[model samples]
Target: MTRKAAEPSRRQPGPRRDKEPLHCIAACGREVDIGTCVIRWDQPGSLVCPNPRGRSACTRHDPRLNDAPTLPFSRYRIHNPDQAYEELKKTVHQFVLHYDVCWTSRHCHQLLADSPFKGSHFYLDLDGTVYQTCDLYWKTNTAPADDGLGNERAVHVEMANLSWQARAEESGLHLLQTDAYRKTDAGWLLNLPAGRRQELRLQSFQPLAARAYGDRGYFSRKINGRTVRMWDFTEAQYAALIRLCRGVHELLPRVRLQVPWDPEQRRTPLDRLPGFSRFEGILGHAHVQGGNKNKGIKRKYDPGSAFDWGRLRRALSR
Candidate 1:
């Protein structure tokens, strides 16, 4: 009732080479040097194409040779897995080769350096003072009883003093501290601007007031043929006063100011007294003007002097 199907016969492969340096093709009988050829197919543990060219062979025995699969879709190709993988890695490396290219332009190098991820840094010395945004006084706040002193009695200078000290420290400003003015056992010494010591030496004339008043701070001398005033300190004037003296008088050009020190013993309150009474011997005046020399130069007074309107304005601005 049913026709029987024929059974297929199994084929065993030929003998293998014994220590041979080269191989030969099965169909074409072409000799393939070991260096130029590799194994292709296999059947039951025996090689089908004993030798294979780098390229696929011409179609004679290959049943699907005319329609062979290509790289993107191929499944049956006998490619050397090691060589194929190496070639893939080399292609990727060449594609990314620009990473190793040295930066020759200054701007490009700077751009690379500026990346925040790289972690680099530097610093600068920025200068100048930050002024208060608004004016403050006792009249503005009704915390105290009214006195004839008006706003002066209500004024608390401590806040201003504290603010200045804080800002100076935070900003790295070269402000002199109150402690620097306190009297020490050391002689009345302070820092001087460079070369001012030389200027002091060159203008060697002593002020007559120094001798007449018996004040260690008075140097009422003439410099560059111009009238000048000088003062001696009692350690409370602060060290910065010393530099200010040198800067205004000897270092900078054509700067004149009230004598920073006095032959007379003085305090900040001494100036507020009547006739400047308690300040009598403690305070001496210098006629800071160009006499025969700087007749055109004007006198500059200290901050709290009766004649110091300009100084008051400067303080208010600060």
Candidate 2:
């Protein structure tokens, strides 16, 4: 983004009105109540003073009126992305990761730019393309329901895709057969033999992180009387997630690191989560609200069961 320097204003001050109070609309931090002043509004919606021919001279002179300071385009850094991470160190406390469960990155970007969800700091596509949306210093209005955990104090990241099979393909990984079965009216639908299912149960199931940011509902859906839960994420996406998290941590040294699948802290109340404090480190949206039966509210379960916490922890540690 291009940067422009502030310039001097050439407009003269308006004539002083002794009986009337004078006020400046340029936000130049000048007060005009006690005595006569030259401040006046020349036109509607215009910040500069008109400076009428016979009016009193303006007591305040600001150079910025001539040329306002220019911020980077969209107040964001896309080329040197690490600079953006460095810029966020001061104000950001939490780093939240979300999956844009859409089919493609284009759809994800369009959806996020719309109302309510328009505040994410970065977007990482399946191909590892990172797009900086808002300025690092700007606070987005994401996650308002979480009180102190909203866009004001946190940086949000979005990854795109849907389901484990798709995620594995995108990441060049293979999905192993499992005995897990979905119970439907037609009877039990098994992905593998019952004996194999038991063996697979001992292992973790990894799915791609595919789900819209706004979809915070139950992961399971009833299809033809069958309960089906889908989840996924690509290896490239996971690697990008690790890099992103590490970059954020390095920039903001005080931020604590956290993953959603904390076995010891299972079923922890939302209010009691780590986000209540500014010192709390990085955490997942799932950590804030996971599962359909979370306390009283039916919270979201995105970055759902398929996300591999073990891998994420190992990667961050490295």
Best by lDDT: 2
TM-score of 1: 0.15
Could you give candidate 1's per-residue lDDT for residues 158-205 as a string of tens digits? 000111111222323336342211222443232332332232212232
Q: Candidate 1: where is the Cα deviation over 4 Å? A: 1-185, 202-318
Give one digit per residue, the lDDT tens place, for model 2 in 182-270.
33343332233343223321223232233322243114433222332544455556765666665455445445555534467653222
| TM-score of every candidate relative to the true structure | 0.15, 0.48
Superposed on all Cα atoms, model 1 deviates from the true structure by an RMSD in Å of: 42.2
Local distance difference test values of all predictions, in order: 0.20, 0.42
Pick out the ten consecutive residues of candidate 2 with the lowest summed lDDT: 48-57
